[model samples]
Target: MEEVQTQRESEQETSDESAQSDQDDNQPIVSPPTQPEPSYPSERLKRAAHMLFFKRGRVPGAKAWELKAGIGKSYEKVLDQLDEELKELDLQVKKVEAGGIGEYSPEDDEADKFRYFVRLRGTLTPKEARMSGWRIDNLAALAAALSLVVSKQGKVERKELEIMIAEKAGRWRTLTLTDTFLRTGYLEEDETGMISLGWRTKAEVDLPSLMMLVAEAKPQDDDAEAPATSSMEESVPQPSEEQSTE
Candidate 1:
């Protein structure tokens, strides 16, 4: 009886050990903790500045999507940084609607509808403004084009535009400069040859301020400025006495 009892005790001990072994085997594996990604590189701001200041393609500046793809999803943060830096240099980073001029809401930034530009932070002196590479006639043509479009409530037929610019800039110069404006995005031309303000104009110009200055301008003897001023003054709408009272 003692031998049988001892053998049973040993068998019970082995069964207990086997159960513990199965429990150990069934335990879930735990991995080491993963770390989060590091902060973006510091050079992203520099990359953003280069992208903004240079015209590398069909347009003057970079699309928001392009900057996001090349830099990061937080590319606007870098742009904000760039804008701050530009303040000292009298320049700024501006984003405008890509296709046409309208009410610009930065709330739409996530949708890739914006293009960024670097432009003067304040108005340039006339001498400094003339230093820009465009010819005097071309600049006059653009001013006239914008004025005519605004006069017509944001659109004008291409022929009407050509004629208006021609009145100031001459016919041969008008055609060439109008094409340049369309190509460079100061004005947009559709398949129907209807003209309207473009992304560049929206980004760089404040039309209401422009109209006000034109309306207030005294005619100058300088031929280039005179034509642009007179044409703009004629086209710019005036506030009626009733609206002014209000």
Candidate 2:
């Protein structure tokens, strides 16, 4: 009887150990990473900066509901914070009046909206202004593509633009340039796959200035080609009048 009782006690202990082991296996092993709540102003500033960075065109600044829907907070506060941040970078939010291009009219409010325009602090070269935040090679490719479109009266077939770029850099490079320009707001595409100047180009680039730069660049390109052409001509054996007679 003593031996049977001891055997029953051992069995009970084994059963308890198994139950504890099952419970431990069912429990979660790893805790999730902690994410601290950001402050109110920081959240607002983050939204504004995000919009400015990613938005391809002008961001509607005056509409209260627009901000509320987009950022889930007050737009006025966000704009103020954004403006302050931009000032640190020598940039500013520009206010365009109503009836202007890309204007936004809110319900029951006819106030003008602000456009993201980086106001230059002082005299800066075009290359300097653009290269501050943009890739230099991409900018050059953009200029080349834009020149082609602008020469064709503000629009060009996508294939034609690609062919022109491919001449300088291979087909793969042309494709990359096209994608980068479209993403950066320097170019836009239509339903027909037509390429043209985008909203950012319309806002920032002056047409006359661009034309002047293109005009200046043409002479340099021609000068570069002259030497190559002259060399090729000299390499070919010309049939002289004496040789023709012989």
Q: Pick the candidate with the highest TM-score.
A: 1
lDDT of 2 at 111: 36
Kindly list the per-residue Cα lDDT of model 1 for residues 1-246, writing each as its tens digit.
999999999999999999999999999998989997444556888788888878896667788888999898889878887888789999999878764644245666655777889988898676776787776666766776887898899989999888888888887777788888887778988789898888788888888988776678777568787889999999999999999999
* Steric clashes per prediction: 0, 0
Q: Please, what are the lDDT tens digits per residue for candidate 2 over residues 45-156?
A: 7766666556453533333445556776456566666777677677666443333333555643543243444344334577785758866665666777888888999899
Q: Candidate 1: lDDT of 133?
A: 78
**TM-score of each candidate?**
0.64, 0.47
**CA shift at 116, candidate 1, in angstroms?**
1.3
Each prediction's whole-model lDDT (CA): 0.82, 0.68
